[model samples]
Target: MNTVGVRGYSLELRTRIVALVLGGASPGEAAKHFSVHVDTVKSYLKRHHQNTLHIVAKPTGRRRTVMALHEQQLLAQLETHQDATLQEHADMLETITGLKISYKTVDRVFRRYKITHKKNTGRQRTP
Candidate 1:
């Protein structure tokens, strides 16, 4: 997920790499020509052979919850109704967004932001 130093190989370059390798060029020769690793060229060739190169950027993890869009509203609501129970907060969110929601979803949002309980006065994170 950290793509800091990773310069992704584009489709044009990948095709060229694969094509060079398939056209009587060694993987190493194609890699050197493209300034990429031999394994990268080999992987391109493998995907080409498997007819899977067209697949691009498939999602990697669980889809974000519907509650994601109402994060700020939930936080502000919690700020005023800190004593409210999770189910009450969930109902409040439902009313705010007109969406069917559960206490578990609210709890997940709270957990994601490290939202504190009633005991903690500095409950909200300092942005």
Candidate 2:
């Protein structure tokens, strides 16, 4: 049960485990031989049957709030009001698009587009 990388098991091993299970080897037997959990072996078999098994599983996390349609609008907002805070920009975007978004979400979307905005550190330059 060697991992392909630092994350999940290698695709070849998973396929071999599935084949063993399908070729009359019990899931428990495969699990013992492969040093993997019975549930893991069963999941590979089920996923293989359902055509959803891939080398890596789909990413699991909170989905982004802002999408591609909002990218141009956000860029336009930044160009028009370069001094606006992230929260203010989020509010403006929500009002225009009628979708709830947070300051962090706005920042993430901007970063995804490789757009950097001025950060307000509240430090005035000494003359």
Candidate 3:
């Protein structure tokens, strides 16, 4: 889901907003004090009444990854084949782990570990 500007409120903040409303403050007043939407304050009040005032856990967004399960094996393979390109590394990983993974995934893993895929070339002289 696209959540560019959307965000979840903290449990403490929600509870405070609800408390404000319960303590004779209007929903709009609570919203203004908390700098949140009036609808948010209303929702908090509703949740308080329903006794379901809790913080929602965020989605992890972790899909299946070949490298995550076989980091040691992939590291061993890389140690044995330092000159292998990204595609070659991906193919070798697939063959060893029987998990389908793309070269881009391999590149992402390398980047995450701060490992450079490109070889160092001598400095170019400016004419």
For model 1, residues 1-127, the per-residue Cα lDDT tens digits are 2231333567787888888888899999998888888887888889999997656665567866564568887889888987787899889988988876788888888988998555446765333
lDDT of each: 0.78, 0.82, 0.77
lDDT of 1 at 70: 86
Q: Kindly provide the TM-score of model 2 when superposed on the true structure, using C-alpha atoms.
A: 0.53
Candidate 3 lDDT over residue span 36-95, tens digit each: 888888988888888888957566678657546666666677789887888898899889
Give the number of the best model, judged by lDDT.
Answer: 2
Model 3 scores worst on lDDT over the 10 consecutive residues at 118-127
Any idea how many clashes model 2 has?
0
Residue clash pairs of candidate 2: none
Which 10 consecutive positions of candidate 1 have the poorest summed lDDT?
1-10
Cα RMSDs of all predictions?
Answer: 5.8, 6.2, 5.8
The sequence of per-residue lDDT tens digits that candidate 2 reaches over residues 1-127 is 5444445687888899999988999999999999998888999999899886675765677776677788778889988987787899999998899888889988888888787665446653222
TM of each candidate vs. truth: 0.52, 0.53, 0.63
